[model samples]
Target: MKNAIVTGGGGGLGKSICTELSKNGYAVAVLDLKIKDAQRTSEGLENASAYAVDVRDHSSVIEFYKNYGKAPELIVNNAGIARFNKLLDQKIKDFEDVIQTNLIGSFIFASEGVRLMIKEAKKGSIINITSIHSVSPGIGVGAYSPAKAGLASLTKLMALEWGEFGIRVNAIAPGFIDSGMSKPFFENPKIRELRGKAVPLQRLGTSEDIAKTVLYLSSDAASYVNANEIIVDGGVIHSVLMHLPRE
Candidate 1:
């Protein structure tokens, strides 16, 4: 069976991706910092295992790959954190936290995952989870936006470097997906209404919406696809400027 590794597989979109991967006949490794959550997710699947890991630590990532005992055919860098604050209100360390998790941590996992796949001479797929903020600026998302933008660039770099090994690298840029991440913003009636009105689909996206795209990219169906960004924003991003109040 094909083996897939999904970082942040313990919750929300990551868990949904694991579920879809399992359904499509892939043996999945659920890696997360939350051991209990990871184990709970794994227990729900037929061919899934949990690895309590912190993707931010290179040593832990390397050790997890070693303990996994085999190279994975697919690696999804879905572990990320968001902290929103105006530049002046944001603490330096909080900004660093966003960069460290969303960018540096992703690099560590991708570098390690590619090493393992290369050692095994395996054909592989790597999917980096970016955000709509990667392409467009958002209010109070200073660090988060830049980190995801960097991640999108990293996705292309990996695709370029790993193509020789028959490994494909791509990214999914999700907008307003209803994970715990979006809960606070959506809780306010005005905010929720505005978000819904922003999207052409008239609703926020679900984790499953992004997961379905990830599954398709990992499968043979997307065999020739590489170094691309798939936006799952429900068309909000396209007409964002149109929604701005006229001067």
Candidate 2:
């Protein structure tokens, strides 16, 4: 069975990804900062295990592999944090924290996953979960946009450099998904309705929506696809012009 590691695989979209991957026949390792949360996510999934890992900490991530005993062929760099504040009001430390976890953290895990794959001589896939903000920055999202933008660029670079080894690197840019950190915000009926109406699909995206995309990218169906960013925003990002006055 193919082994896959999903960082932040404890709840929300990460948990959904774990469920989808497990259904697709991959032995999954659910890595999260909170072991209990990871365990909760892995429960009832055959061949799925949980490990506590802080993606921003190099030593912590390294320790996971040291204890895991087997290399993973597929990695989903989905761990991230976000802070909402204006650029001017956002603290330098807060901004850096977001960048470290969202951008640098993905880099650390992806690099380690690649090393393991190369050692095992396994053709692997690395999927990074980026946000639609990477292309369309929102107000008061200080560091998130830049971090995701950097991650997207890094995905391309890795794909370009590692394609020779048959390592595929790509990203999914999800817009307004109702999961993880954004769940609380969407819980507000007013905000929820507004967000739903804003999308061209006239509906909010569910965690399963993103999970299905991940499964596709990880499967042989996408064997020839690499160095690409799939936008799963229901055409919301492209609907800005439609918001203007129309005859």
Candidate 3:
């Protein structure tokens, strides 16, 4: 059975990714900071286990993988957080937190996971969950936009360095995915309407929509695809930019 690791699996989008992987017959490791929640998620799956990991801590990630015994064939760096504040209002701590979790954490997990996979001589796939903000920037996203942009660049770099070892690296950039983190904003009718109107699909993205893309890139169907980003934003990027000319 192919072994896979889904970081942040205790949460909404991450949980969906784990479930999708499990449905596809892979043995999944649900890695999250909350042990109880991770275990709870694993219990509902057939061939899944739980691992508690603090993605920000490199030592924690290394130890967690070491204890898991076997190298995972797939690893999704999905743990991320965004604290919104205008550049003028942003504190140093806020910027540090974003860089630490979103960018550095991904590096730590990717490094450790790749080391294990190499030791096991397994051909593996690594998926970094980035944001459309990686390309498109906005106000009140000082740290978030840069962090994701860094991740997107890192994705390409890793793919170039690891492909010779049969390791593939790619990124999934989602646009306004409807999840617990975004539910509050979507609850505001104005925000909801604006989001719908902004996208060509006239609706916000669902976690499953993003998960399906993850499944594709992790499976053999995407074997020849590497160092690329699959955007799951329902054409929002183009819609917004297309209107810029007349403004």
Candidate 4:
């Protein structure tokens, strides 16, 4: 079976990605900071194992690759966090934590994971989970937009450097997903409806939507698709003009 590693696999969207990979016959290593959460996600799928990991720590990441982490055919850098506050109001440390988790964590994982593949002479796919905020910044999301933007740039760099070795790198930037990291925000029915209507597709995105995109990028059909960020936002990113009133 093909081996896959998904960081943040305990979270809502991560679980969906794990399930989709399991269904497609990948033996998955679900990595999360919480062992219990990771175990819970693994329990729902076949050939899935859970691990507690901090992708931000360099030594810890190296130790993981040396011990439990397999040389994966696929790696999904999905672990990230956000703090809600304006730049002036947010604590410096909170902004740092957001950048550390969303950007630095991904760098650590990709660097370590790709080293393993190099040793094993494995050429595979790496998908970074960016956000639509990477393209367009939003107010009150703290450093999330910048972190995701950095991740997008990192995705391109990985592809540029690793493509010669047949390691394809890509990204998915989801917009207004009803589940996962944005779930709490969408819990308000009125706000959810309003946001849904703002989307050109007339609905919010889902975990499955992003998962399927992941699956597509992991497949052989996408062999030539590299260094691209697919936006699965129900066309919400482009609908700002629709909301602008004009007579």
Task: Tell me how many residue pairs clash in candidate 3.
Answer: 0
Please provide, for model 1 over 153-229, each residue's C-alpha lDDT reduced to its tens digit, 9 standing for 90 to 100: 99999999999999999999999877757777788989888888789999999899999999999988999999999
| Cα lDDT computed for each candidate against the true fold | 0.90, 0.92, 0.90, 0.92
On the 0 to 100 scale, the lDDT of residue 172 in model 4 is 99
Relative to the true structure, candidate 1 reaches a TM of 0.95
List, residue by residue over 1-247, the lDDT tens digit for candidate 2: 8889999999799999999999989999999988998999999998899999999999998888889876678899999899999999999999999999999999998897788888886689999999999988889999999999999999999999989888999999999989888999998999999999999999989889999999999999999999999999999999989899977
How well is each residue in 1-247 modelled by candidate 3, as lDDT tens digits? Answer: 8889998888878888988999999899999889887887798898999989999998899899879888789999999888899999999999999999999999999989899888896589999999999988878987999999999999999999999889999999999888846767888889999887788988999999988999999989999999998889999977855657673
Q: Rate residue 104 of model 3 by lDDT.
A: 94
Q: What TM-score number comes out for model 2?
A: 0.98
Overall local distance difference test of candidate 1 = 0.90
Q: Residue 229 of candidate 3: its Cα lDDT?
A: 82
| Local accuracy of candidate 4 as per-residue lDDT tens digits, 1-247 | 8989999999988999999999999999999998898999999699999988999999878887877646888999999899999989999999999999999999999988888787785698999999999999999989999999999999999999999888999999999998877899898999999998889989998999999999999999999999999998988888878889899
Q: Which stretches of candidate 3 lie over 4 Å from their true place?
A: 241-247
Summing lDDT over every window of 10 consecutive residues in candidate 2, give the lowest-scoring window. 113-122
By the lDDT metric, which is better: model 1 or model 4?
Answer: 4
- Weakest ten-residue segment in model 3 by summed lDDT: 238-247
For model 3 the TM-score comes to: 0.95
